[model samples]
Target: MAQPRKPASRGSRRGRKPTSCTQCHLRKQKCDRNQPCNRCLQRGVAHLCGDSINSNGGFKHSQSPQVVSIAPPSPSPRPRRVTQPPMSPSLGTLFANRGARAFYGSSYFGHQVASRILSEEGQDLPAGISRGRDTLQSFRDESSSFAQVWDLLGLLPRQKSTVDRLVNIFLAEVNWSLDAVHEATFRSSYDEFWGRRFGFDDLANVDLRWLGLLFIILAFGVLLDSPPHPTLDVQREREEASLRFYWAARRAIVIAPSFYGESTDIVRAGLLVTRYLLYTRRVSESWLTIGFASRMAQAQGMHVDGERWRMTRKATEQRRRLWSHIYTIDRMISLALGRPYAINNQFCLTHEPENVWLDDMDDEEANRAVPQPLSLPTPSVLSSLLYRLAQVVGKIQEKCFGMERASYEAVLQLDANLVRWSEQLPPYFRLDNPDTAADDALPFLPWHRLYLHTSFHFARIVLHRPFLLRESITDRFRTSHEACMSSALADLKIRLRTMNSTNADSLRWAFGAHNLFNSAMILGIIAVKNPHSAQAGAILEDLEAYCENLHQDPWLNEFGMAELKVVELCISKAKDSRYTSMTAYPSGTPPEPPGPRIQAVDGSGRMRPSDLESPAMSSDMSSIYWPTVWEDGQFTFPGAADFSTWEQMITGIAEDNYGGQ
Candidate 1:
């Protein structure tokens, strides 16, 4: 009792306001019981009222505390108060400063200093400005400043040094927007300064070798942008410069040996010489140059003797390699210009009728047909040139034949035999296929045969007078003829086996029928000229039978039909017309009549013969017949008939004008 000692009266107990049960028990804080206590409610924390303080420490209200106030605590010291500095002005703004900007824009030292500062700060600038800096640096490194000289003489620097410095400057400015400046400077100083210094009388007389060296240095100077520079004109200038240097070096080699003792340079010069000569119309000269270059390369151990320059092993392989690259480049140029490359000797043989046909034969016949020394013409200049050309082309073709080496030889033999075949056919054996027998045989025989004949004819023409065929001429004809023949044979075979099925019909539809007639015409030409030995004739007859069974096919379009008509006409003329009554025409003439003339207007508005000419008309009936009749109604024996018609035919066909016609 004395126990609680009357737990000192509430206010007097601690000498402070009495604590609320909520504060003392739940929150453990002193509470006055004011409307909102500073400790809890002011902090937005909820306040709970304890049972109203029991007067005697006995219950005066519910056991659990009652709510007095409701509030939340202030958030913890706002996350450490971070701070950041303001953003700096962009490059544009800095450049926009009136006083400094004008100085930066000026061409004087102020601008240079500003550029240096900006560059140090890693800022971007116009390419021209950057290029100017590069050029200045290169010049500084290559030439001593005028300030370094003890005397200020009025005389100019030596020509060689001046030229070197100018070239160096040009090279330095290559990457800059200084192209205009470089060009202007180059043009102005080239003749009066550099040209005179180098002992050149004029731009044309400038040592091509020196020019080439300069250009090579320039070419290797600047780095190229992959997508290319934004300015195509600049790119083009660079390329042209490189090519000029290359050509100059090449010309120097063609003219004379390198002045310097660098064998590599000499090799490069020779390669270029060959390339330049090949690109020109001087085919003979080009070949000679190439030969000389090859020899030089070999002598210098740049190339192996047996390998030419193409496949070689040597310490100076790079120099040897240049020859191969030059050869290839020149060849391409020749093709583009429709000029003949020295290596294109196999020209008409691969594409001409005679050669192509011969190429399509069995190896035995091809091997047997190789012209012996007796058969081949002796090596005169023209013959020598032809032989060289042929040898080169033959080598190329042999390589192309790859695994099927025999194929090329086969084709060549077929071509060679064509002329002989043409000479053996009888005059009375018309090409008409009464039983359509020739139709079956025609596609296979006539095209192959004609291909050979035409090829030989072209070769003779080129030998007598060289002319450039268009780049795609041979390829176009070869592809078209091959397609036509392939389709026809497939159809003929299908027709022979399956007479009425829809599949057979479809195949026949796809395979042209006119091919049969075309093939037969070709065969007839070959047969009529050579009454093939019985064995050959039998083979041809069998081939003919195999070809005629295809249905009325449609692949033979109007143009193809026209060609077939021409073939038929030629076969008929050969067999029926007693004109020359010759078994075979001379080397270059065809057996057909020339058709019509095509013309074009010249610049002066006058009519002139067009690039192409029409086929020639047949000789007048009287002219053709009277002589034969007078001589005897019987056909002239082989080599006995007047050859005028044959000559005219050959001339007409061989004329460039008659090409397509």
Candidate 2:
């Protein structure tokens, strides 16, 4: 065996100097060595342009890039013991360079993350795919990124029946919740593809971006199969195939730069992709993806009024619809992550979408419809309702989750505003007025009801979640806490029942598995905190049903079933205690209230459990043995704040590609 070579000393004299940036020099390429240097600017890692102590063991230029390394790069390209490849930079070392070392100075740290990623990927980069090359160019080959997606998912079957069936499934299952693309447009595209191609060889008829969108739609059709067909092996196979296509679509989009263009296709795909990422519980990645879609919308001026751009009436409506979806996604993700909204309201002036869905418009007449006066506004009741929710979500983030802590009075005012919002909603959309719902709107009534209710309850959760950290609830804050519990119970009750019901349907809906997941968690904690309550049995049942609904989803399988089992077991123990008491003292008499007296950590006095066996009812807890909301069995379920590390890395590429906010 050979010994490792000693690193060269900085004072050592070296050979002839190289004329390249540190990145270029490290990769053995020519460098323009401009301010950001050609390679750094090309890779959009311009901020990472500083020269390291170059291989010559001396400063190459006075205008050296400010980047610092853990230590100098190995003097020679290959270490003395060439049998094994050297390790790329360690995570701790990269973080240190970015944080304490302040690698980028005043520039955003997003690029630092990308540079480190390319550094780590250095060992495997192909000869033509240089590290400092354009970021998009480097990602042109995504086979590794989407290894599971290489196989065709049969999204475009030759049989018209099969294509129709899958299309129906997507439309029937998730369309209401996502309403991502116009159904008419989607079917037309599907028809065009199936009519022409039985394989990839004839796929030229479909645009790469649209093909990607089609794959996602098919994947969602399989992934969103609720109350799945119990006896069908084919359904299972399709699901497996759908996931492969979904990931392949993900990979394909990254490979096709045109997919990111500021057009409806990219915006639709981005929104749906973000939604799919979130549903699969890829919460952090969803946040990152939504940022891309949001920027794309901004680039297309979707954030501004159509009149300002001189767009046609139909074009304006399409822009509004796209903007609405992006805005909702933005709010949902920001709230889910407890982060600030990426779209600054000060810069946004796009009007809310009108009552007309694109499906209702005739393409020929759509142009003529643009001249209608804005004063006679009739909103897309469902879309507009969701848009309002997004607005509230934005404020909730700012007033509640932002740098400032809202006062008791401020919280109360916001609560009142939420209530007022529901009151002002169109009568038919209100939960209380289903009997008066329009005949044509009946198809979507249940969805709207649930959506309206979920928004109210979820908002309540955000508003009072802070109370859990408080040592005590004061008189002013007492109502707010009560409201939180009340809304949570209400949110769970309707959501669980509607989702489980045979008749439930929505034409264009918001709120589903994602909402239910959170709802189950809130209810579980409430049941655990007050375990002896009469409602405990129902709470456990709700959790059981939620688990069933989510079990079919591969990405959610681990957290979904595992979290349910934990909640069920805890509640079961309490139920057993209750049964024992009832057996001791028969029916007519009051048996001893069941379960431990463990009050959950509600941010007030109940920080820790009252005693050991009982713990805080938190889905986000670090462990199942302790108190956890939803944890991976492998002990790696990303906590709400735990995703912070990935947040930077995930969004890093967006900064490089989209050129930052």
Candidate 3:
């Protein structure tokens, strides 16, 4: 029978938001109200809301219905049973039981049994399989116990530990690959992958300025920690490898189209790579690295010309003073390498203006002034490059032969050449401009300083040689010394005058002061050897006064102070030492002296020597005095001196003992 409808109460008739289902509301308890209220629907209970069945057995209806009524039907119930299909085994169970048992269970059996079965079933199984099976069986027999197998499994190392152990191996592999790439690209070595592909061409296409600096650093690093190669050929091969890697990394930096901040990583990597190349003696490649970097800077809106590949006037002129310094470094390197002056050989500077006047040119003028075919300049950066190269070469020579006669001679030759070349540089070459004022004259002190230091060191080597007096080399050395000193002094005077000028705050002026003082010290040392040379003494006094002035000044650098002290020590030694001269013998006379004669014994048992007298000498003896054997007509100063005393003086100066920190 269907259920009858229930009548709604007056309160229920009012409109309100439904909080719960009608069945739950009627039950008056919390309900989830999923499909039906649990209490009402689960119990199959249908109760009226505060109402009873009508007398006519008909559903009662109210103004608003609380619930719908249903008619009750006669019960004729019969339940039916349903059968379900079987489920298949899961993948995990299948793999664990069937697959594992098949593979591992047979292996646990003796290899004899397994091999016999394999032989019967297989047509041509690999011979190694029997060995593998035997090993597996042995392992299984050994670890038969559950606890043993469990412990063995637990004893295995973790993934993290394994990864840590392989980290160095991975890094070494990467380095090797990068080096191979580098060799193929820049060193003209045949690295199959790098050579066939044009991977490094992009890197080569980058600006040269950046590449030059980077290459130097790289070559320097390699040279410092030379590769473990038996021969020069192998070493060169490895170096070329390093170069290719550097180029690739640089190429990556250039092509990376991203924000400046994002590109820093690439730039930093390129810098590090280039530094390594430079440390390796791959100087040519290093220059290329610098070129690339300069291009990159230009590409980033730095105004660099691609054809004559150099930074624009506006960009470089701001740092124009650095040009001399850059030029000096390049020159030094070329000299050290014993290569002909090829400015564009390793690095390109076609974009740099020929004249300083171009720096101030207007746009229209600059456009017209730009040369049709940019000619490469001479090796202008030789000085600074030579300075750095000397340091590197000195280290190399020291390792090969410490204070060897041959090494010293070679050093002297280089020094002599440097001085000669520097002197030969025309005044116009030194002068940045025709109208450059006396105060603004290009400082020659740096050139003089470099010359004097190199020369003095060369002189020390000469004086230290045991056979210098016997050898004809001394004459050649003396001549070179005079030439170097005279020219150095002339340049020194100009530098000193410039330093004393009012515009001393200028970078050139400051450098002039430093170079002047430094050159004076070197000259002072040279003078000590030639104390009789009036010019030498005058220069020494001038140097001393300069040092004193520096001590008074409050702005000298620590390095400058140290150098000054070295000069002072050289001067003090020169003043205190006694000068001696080597005597020249007549060309035809026998070089050997007369032998000493033995006298007859006077005693009977033991032989006793009697005083021997020479044959009667002439009453009138002519005494002949010759000029002292001055090195090139200059006195020789003792090469050995405690340079530490000078070091201390400089230290005191640096520490502000003179209130000039």
Candidate 4:
């Protein structure tokens, strides 16, 4: 069976190497080397077999190996399969741009997009790198671990009574605005959750989104119940506990793997997170998070009327409530920051939530259950009313503040719409009703009433703020001026009431702070421009009270100081004005007093760009009328014509210095 091996031919001898070819040497296998080695030919790397390609038998620095040799195939040769190197699998083409990646430090490639491309391309990533599917699978696996779930639950106060109290606080004080969680449904789930935690059921079956909802509730309770001015140690303890609960909530949401989640619970959790972010003064982050939650809700077709999809009655009502809440928050946050909102009402088909109690929705005969008339107040009446008002606010944002200068006709129309909304309110909820004390018996009604009035007044301010300047002042514009001032003063009274109420702790939040700050700014502007007006004393008193209130709230300290400085600056300017004794202008336009005197052909007291040729800017900085401090910390009067610039300066200070916090 065995014959002596034939002597190598001259060409075969020339082809055979003394050592292994580069491919075989690098692979550490025996090589029957020729121009193309036997191993290379078998592995389909015959074109890569050359000893001179790499002297030390290591790989070249090139991204891909060089093809050094290829032999013509024989007739009827066996099919060859291409094999990749064991050490480095082929990555093929990257989805990300190399230049952009280098410039932007790798984050230029979004995780979701990159993961999708890599998965499609069948690409290999380096060790420990996580792809999207890998991340989701890990989350699912971790969620199955009872120990991990238990560890998260263990971070909370263990007493059932304590937990109940916390949940009750959130439900009573905060949930009225959000209505993200239904009390009955949440209570039922919470009971089952604790049962599972205590081993009555499987922990693996627990819903992380609902668990996160509970954690968010606890965080709110801890934050809302903390004393106004706690001891440093106590404050620190409270902060740590609140943050612990908040982060646990966030972790639980991530474990729910809510990135692609479209469930009501996940969307509700996201909504609550936005609210929490807003309360904590992370405004921009809240805006971004709300957008994410909006997308999730939209993915579930929550933006469209659920009836069109023929969903269950209960599901329809829930989607409606949640969508209204989402839209409201989106408009509020976006309008507050002068950013565009996520939902355009024109494209949305979801109906407003019916004025029905949450309990009524759970009725077995829900289809037969009738919604309460708007004439009667229900538990959800506040939410229903707010939803309606938010619609008006959204319109105002679009018609009035949406452009550089809205037409007077559009302003009147939006103002009328606001008036109609107010007039339609029930007598019990009417801001103009003398009996503010009547609603105290109803839980959260007093608070809701205050909120409703403050929002209405704030809307009035926003609707008319553009024309508040002296340059824009005229008899026709007189209506806007009065509206701006009256609303500002009305909002101030409400603020004082809130500070004195038992609900003060719950009301000490940034949502109302923005309203208060805007009101204070408007009042300050009026007081400086019209120092001799009869209402000046009252305005200053209110502003002083506001500053005091701001000083008391730890969250509002910086804003409070900034407001104080502005108020003080206005008062000083008023006292120094030569027209202190002059009565307010009958036409509602205040006289512009002489300041850093730079004469011009137009003695209209309005400064022009050419007026800057004078040495006023370089002159002594001490004497000017209501001098404005710019971003660079330098004071400039600029002129009466530049009053809008002053407003911008103040707003800029607030946005730049305090908005992020």
Best candidate according to TM-score: 4
For residues 1-661, could you state the per-residue lDDT of candidate 1 as single tens digits? 3655455565332444345644334434466665444433332222233443556644342222222343445664333332221222122333321111221233322223322322232344321222223323432342523111111111223355644554554444331211112233334534543524222111222333334434333333321211222255655564454445444454444443322112334444454444333322234455555555544444343333223323222211223224343333333333222344543332211111111112223445544543333222211111222222333334333432222222323434433443343343322111222122353433333222222222233222211111111112234224323332333333333334443334213222222212212333333333333332233244245344533332232222333344334434334443332223223444323344465332333342222332322222223622232211211111111111224443343233323222221
Evaluate model 1: give its lDDT. 0.32
- Which scores higher on lDDT, 1 or 4? 4
lDDT of candidate 3 over 1-661, digit per residue (tens): 9999777653443454344445445434465644433443333332312122234433332212232344455485434433221221122221111001121222322122222222232222222222222333433454432123223223222453442333233233322212112221223221221233232121211222223223333432333243332365755654564455345445445533221111212333443443343333344454554444433333332232323225345334322223322333333333333232223323433233233333345545655664332122222233332334334334323322332213335545555544454444434334223222322343443433334344333322332321121113224335445544654565455545554322112222332212312356547545554444456558777777767766754333444556566777666655543122112323322233244222232332112222221112223212100011111112222121335434332232222211100
Task: Estimate the lDDT of model 3.
Answer: 0.35
TM-score, every prediction: 0.23, 0.60, 0.33, 0.64
**Cα RMSDs, all models:** 35.1, 16.9, 30.6, 13.1
Using lDDT, rank the candidates from best to worst: 4, 2, 3, 1
Predicted structure 4, TM vs. truth: 0.64
TM value for model 2? 0.60
Candidate 4 segments whose C-alpha is farther than 4 A from its true place: 1-165, 176-180, 197-204, 227-229, 258-260, 358-361, 434-441, 472-474, 501-505, 508-517, 553-661
Q: What is the C-alpha lDDT of each candidate?
A: 0.32, 0.55, 0.35, 0.61
| Number of the top lDDT candidate | 4
Model 2 CA deviation exceeding 4 Å by range = 1-161, 168-177, 187-206, 223-228, 232-235, 258-260, 357-359, 362-379, 433-441, 468-474, 501-517, 532-556, 573-661
Candidate 4: residue 376 Cα off by (Å): 1.3
